[model samples]
Target: MSTTEEPTQGTTISVTEQAAEEAIALLEGESMDTDIAGLRLYVQQGGCAGLSYGMRFDNEPEEDDTIFEHHGLRVFVDPASMNYIEGSVLDYEGGLQGEGFHVENPNVVSECGCGESFRT
Candidate 1:
């Protein structure tokens, strides 16, 4: 992870160290090449708030996707999704009461009661 005072230009999102570690392990388990494979983050219309965060392992990013590397984990986001999730942070919280992977999106103005959706 580059930890300079300035963030990488055009970096719209980042992943926490813990989340990156977990994601790497999962990618390895899937036998996917971490160098090219990445987790795709996007927004979809659904849930009570009209927008929901979606994530899935992608073999590679699309030509129009914006890619960022944080803590050695690659995250791919499309142009449309970038408008809604800029400056967001992806994190993982696990314990007895776990809240798996979640996005802390600064663009969100409100979230649904279920916490699965948000309105920007």
Candidate 2:
């Protein structure tokens, strides 16, 4: 990572060290080409709470995507999705609570019971 106090200007999302580590592990474990692969995070219009988060490994960025690098991990977010996830902190939690990437989004006003979606 750059080790800067703040994310670069225009950066809409932030990834924690743990999240970056986990993401890197997952990407590497998949046996994909890491050089051109990145984690894509976005929002969709369907879910119990009206909006759901979608994430996957992308080999290329869309024309309107914004990319951020944290601890050598690349995170891709689309312009529209950026509005709902600005200042969000991405973390990976394991053990009894659960295991996976969790988004701590400040813009969120409500979330579904299952935590799969949120309303901002």
Candidate 3:
């Protein structure tokens, strides 16, 4: 597992060390199993950028993929989706504004006004 900072210009892409650490902390207290391994981040066809982000807790990984570790949290990305989400960050933000997990993707060329969809 390696930890490094990869920066980008738009939407503050690239998952930061702090974000990963926070993810782990939240997961630990969610009443779920702490042995969840890590999160799987991917891009699927749909949404307003012709592309959309997908995330889930997964224990198994496919044969060819990149696994990144930040503050003991592991994040997995499949090769196929990597091209679309190369410089994106996976963040968990909570507050009255709207508490939920969000993706800050720089590759997004246009997004739906609702902010639930994007096109790139």
Best by lDDT: 1
> What lDDT score is found at residue 12 in candidate 1?
64
Highest TM-score scorer: 1
lDDT of 2 by residue, 1-120 (tens): 322244557556888999999998899998856666789999899888999888999886777677777887888888788888878888899999878998889889999999998899
Segments of candidate 1 deviating more than 4 angstroms: 1-11
Residue 94 C-alpha lDDT in model 3? 68
Per-residue alpha-carbon lDDT of candidate 3 for residues 1-120, written as tens digits (9 for 90 to 100): 122333223312345666676667666766545454677788887765466777877664565656665556777777677777767777778678976678887777888877876776
Q: Please identify model 2 stretches exceeding 4 Å from their true place.
A: 1-11
Candidate 1 vs candidate 2: which has greater TM-score?
1
Task: Report RMSD (Å) for each prediction in the order shown.
Answer: 4.0, 3.9, 4.8
Computed on alpha carbons, the lDDT of every model, listed in order, comes to 0.87, 0.82, 0.66
Model 1 C-alpha lDDT per residue in residues 21-95, reported as the tens digit of each score: 999999999999998898999999999999999999999888878788888788888878888998999999998
- Tell me the TM-score of model 1: 0.90
